[model samples]
Target chain A: MRDLLRILSRFWRASLAAELEYRVNFVFSTLNAALGLVLGLFALSLFFQNGHAFDGWSFDASLVVYGLFTTFSGISSVLFVPNLSRVVEHVDKGTMDFVLLKPVDSQLFVSTRNFSPWGLPDIALGLGVIGYAARRLDVDPGHVPAALLAALLSLIILYSLWFALASTSIWFVKVYNATEVLRGLLDAGRLPIAAYPAGYRVFFTYVVPVAFLTSVPADVLRGADATSWLAIEVVVAVLAFGLSRAFWRLSLRSYTSASS
Target chain B: MTFLRRARAFLEVYYAYMLVYRSELLLWALAMSLPFISMGAWIKAADTGAFPLAPVEFGRYFLVVYLVRQLTVVWVVWEFEYDIVQGRLSPRLLQPADPVWHYVGGHVAERAARLPFTVVIVAFFFMLYPEAWFVPSWTETVACLALSLLAWVLRFVLQYAFAMAAFWTEKASSIEGLWQIGFLFLSGVVAPLAVFPEAVREVVLYTPFPYLIDVPVRALLGAPITLRDVLIPGAWLLVALVAQRLAWRAGLARYSSMGA
Candidate 1:
């Protein structure tokens, strides 16, 4: 595990240097991320115009959900998605064979290859949004530790979700936009999960795992009921990780390229 | 006759390509359906009185929104950016046909091929919400339909200009993300502008994003729309077109593609 951390740190440095060569892009990306936050705020404000609260949650609660989803999405995009998008390219160009031949796990290398340091702006902006939304909701600082734990779990679920979705690309070469679909599904998290019909809320929470990514963290931040779901979240995260690992290995068996 | 001949030849090639990769087109269309799902959620929310929105109104509004998105969303910018990065743009530029015309032809052809799928979605909306298809006045519906066409043209041109930034910038994906966020909030994909703050809605009225989707959707769903409403969106369409031209001209000079 320490060696893995050392390797990731080296890869991260390499990625930063490569990205820094095009510095203006960093500014544009920051601006782009800021625009996403602005849009989320605007959407929340629009929803609030219709009612003081949607379903049982106040506008502040919804914003917390949006912010949490944004934070998770931003981190996922920063750390995992860029590498995931490149999976097709590597496969098409036969560069994936190199990854398979590496001493480390091919999945690990492929999953961490394209870390973008510039996406840190999104993380900062998302956290700021979450902080502001928490303040609006009058959330207590005493709950900060729990909220952080929920947020970390949410990030794990999100990362695992991406892994599961992206692993399909190894088998289905046509699935270039699966990550976008995942992103869009995450966008569903921008709204308060409780605002959805009970059936959808249940599905999102249990089946799809969106609730863990947005609602649970938001609820924890709001001092709402989240403890009951914490154990379920952990179980789901572990299951998701196991399933994705299985899928990744299955895909590898069918991979045409060989180290030879 | 000469123009028709060229158009036919271009469309033939385009259709052939579409047939070969038809699944990709279907996937793209399916990927775009998340907004419809959000609209569905809003409709149900309205049914439960979660918001002031009437269920039928929400249905009508979102159907129009989905259709407008189909017409207005442009993929040119990202396509150019990818082509540039992959070193394919240079060869395309060397072709006898102007690259812009080729792209326009490609987009037009893709739109044509996808028409069946778009119509199926519209038909589903019609079946589910007959009230949304209600036409109080034929003249109004016709005028709105015309405006919708104009809006799509302007939207495509606007996005093409932005996409042209790939000629200079390495972060066109970030630029596209910013535009998408703007579209989500300002363009009425999240909800109708009527749901936004008066001041915010008023400011957005001046921007091109609303005309891209919201205005046309409103005009279509609220058929028998006033002459003034019809004219405002038309005027914005003209402005968008002009803005697109200026941006395109400025961007073209900076484009070096992969060779440079």
Candidate 2:
């Protein structure tokens, strides 16, 4: 764990230096992320314009979900997305040989090799929105621990899901589309799960488990019982990660260097 | 070669290219379906007297929004940014044809290929809510189709213009992202413009953003579309064309001056 942390720190330093080479990008990305937050809030306001509550979610609850979605997406963009999406290119070009030859765990190295420091603005904006929403909802401080736990579980599940998809690049060679699928599923997280039709609700809640990503955390913030959902999230995260790791190992055995 | 012949060749090449990337195109189409998330919220609100729309009406509007979205979405900014940054634009610059035409041809061909998928989605939606499906008059259908084509053109030009910012900065996609946030609210992607405050709606109607998605969608849904609605987008199209030409010329000058 310490070695992983040290390697991540080194990677992050390099990423920061690379990003800082373009100062204008810092300004534009910050503005872009801020605009994303504004759009999320604007959408929520539009929904509340028709009613105070949507399905069973109060405005504040929905805002919490929106905030969590932004935060999760920001993290994904910064960490998992940039790294996992590269698996397709690596597999296509036979660059995975180098990744496999690395001294550290291949999955760890592959998943944390790059970071986008610009994505921090989105995370900051998301936390701000979440704090603002919590204030409006008068959320109990007692629930903060549970919400954080759920958030961690959500991240784990999402990472595992992305890992599994990225591993398929070994066979499919075009599995970068998996990132788009992940993105589409995350968009569904913008709304409370209850708002969806029965079939969609089931699909999102169980099949993809996107409902656990944002809505469950937001539900915890809203003082709802999230214990059952948290349990499911933990189980899903473990199963997903184990299966994905096994798949990655199995796929690696089939990989032939492009040069060969 | 004549413009028509050159365009035909480009179309054939890009159609084959798009066929190879059909999964990616389908993934993008799925990613752009954010309207479904909003649809769920609005449908629930409608059931509870929060929204003026009946659940079926919300269903129909969002279903149409989905189709319009698929038809109008543009990724030229990302494509151009990639070309500029990766030095790929240099070879294209030597070609007699404007590289922008390549992008236009690719997008148009992809859309053509995507028609069957769109029809499948529409059919599935209609199956779920047959009562919500409304076929407009033949005249209205013709008008909607024309406006939708215009909308696609405007979106393509606008995004191409935005992508030209790559000549000045590395973060042109950030600008595109910001522009998309504006479109999300102003283009009636999140909700019908009728649901917005009247003053905001009036101002939004005057902007080019609405022409990108809203006007065509409203027209397709058999909603009232005034002469001004048509005229505004027509004027915007002319403006966009001029702007695109200027930006392209200036961007190419900068690119050459930098010896890239």
Candidate 3:
């Protein structure tokens, strides 16, 4: 626990320093994120304009899904996008040698080191949407703490899924393009799972876990109370993380530096 | 050798590169089918007779959106940003043909090679929804195709100009993200601009982004096409072309190649 905290502190400090170097970009990103937040909310309004229920979910219910999507996606942008790009860099430069020399887990370090400090703007905006939606839905403040917890757990599952995909760069250098593939799947989060057909809902919820990132938490927020879903999320996350670790280790064993 | 001869030689070589990566090309084309997936969900919901657009109408709208997305999607921003930053642009500049034109040729060539796959996918989707074909009148089809091509060029030039910002700033990645968020909302990738509130839709149409996706898509689907419709999107494309020219001229002068 202490070691993990130390690493996280160091990572945060590095990100802060890097972000501080480009203050104007940070401000622009914040404004950009806020604009996206407004657009997301407005989109919901437009959908509700036509009628009330969309795929059996109320406007407020779908709003929770959108809110959770922004929150988890913010977590992803903050953690994964920055780090996943480095996988491509490492592959291009044959820099796996440096990673292998580390005493600690190379995959962990690589996956965690590319933190961007400015992504919190999206997180804050997501909270504002969720709060507004909660008011509109008449959700109890007592449920807020549970929603936050679910969001964190959901974020964990999301991070693991991304890391597993990024680790594929060890064997398939071209897999960097897969990040966009992942983003395409994540885009499904914009709507609630209840809005999709049965096959799609099943595919997203279990097969890919795309729905878990937002829909499940939103369902809980709407009083569906699927806490068992969180347990499944934690299990999937751990399994995914382990698979990535194994892959990284096996690839390192065959690393044979890209000297050519 | 003559300029046309050299151009032919370059085209031949570029074609070979694309053939080698044909699988990746197919995947890239398939990746653009997110709109189709969304269409499925919406159509299924509309099938229940509860939503605004009927299943057939929803199919027509989303199919158009899918095609427009393919026409307007630009990965060149990242490609150009890398070339400029890594000094690859310097070597290209030494070539007889203008580097930008050469880059555009290569980009177009890749798209041309993939055209068959794109057509097949579109045909397959259309077959899957024969009732929702929205078969355009021949004149409307020709006009829509023309505007779609213009939208394609507008998107490419705008993104290429945005990518050239590497000459002035180190945070091109963040800038790209900002651009994407803007494109997502303004280009109607998240939802149709028609779905947006009236005031918001009015303001967004004044910008060039919508021409890149929404206008061409709506036009192709046989949605309210008029001389005024053509004029508005045409004006935006013209303005983009002018801005692109200015930005490219300025950016080329300031470009410090990677060797330095």
Q: List native contact recovery per candidate, as a fraction of 1.
A: 0.43, 0.64, 0.30
Q: Which candidate is the best by TM-score?
A: 2
Cand 2, B chain, TM: 0.93
lDDT of 2 by residue, A179-235 (tens): 776777678887788767777788898888889889888988788877888788788
**TM per candidate:** 0.90, 0.94, 0.89
Q: Write the per-residue lDDT of candidate 2 for residues B6-104, one digit (tens) a residue.
A: 989999999998898777777776666678767776777677666656898888888888988888878899998888888888888779987878888
Residues B89-110, candidate 3, lDDT per residue (tens digit)? 8887787777776666677678
Q: State each model's C-alpha RMSD to the native.
A: 3.0, 2.2, 3.0
Q: How close is candidate 1 to the true structure, as a TM-score?
A: 0.90
Residue pairs in clash, model 2: A50-B50
Instruction: Give the per-residue Cα lDDT of candidate 3 at A130.
Output: 85
Worst 10 residues of 1 chain A by lDDT: A44-53
Candidate 1 regions off by >4 Å?
A136-138, A258-260, B48-52, B83-97, B119-141, B225-260
Q: DockQ of every model listed?
A: 0.50, 0.61, 0.45
Task: Tell me how far the alpha carbon of residue A67 in candidate 2 is from the true structure, in angstroms, after superposition.
Answer: 1.5
Q: How large is the i-RMS for each model, in angstroms?
A: 2.5, 2.2, 2.8
Candidate 2 segments whose C-alpha is farther than 4 A from its true place: B257-260
Q: Identify the superior model by DockQ, candidate 1 or candidate 2.
A: 2
Would you list the rank order by DockQ, best first?
2, 1, 3
**lDDT minimum window of 10 residues, candidate 2 chain A:** A47-56
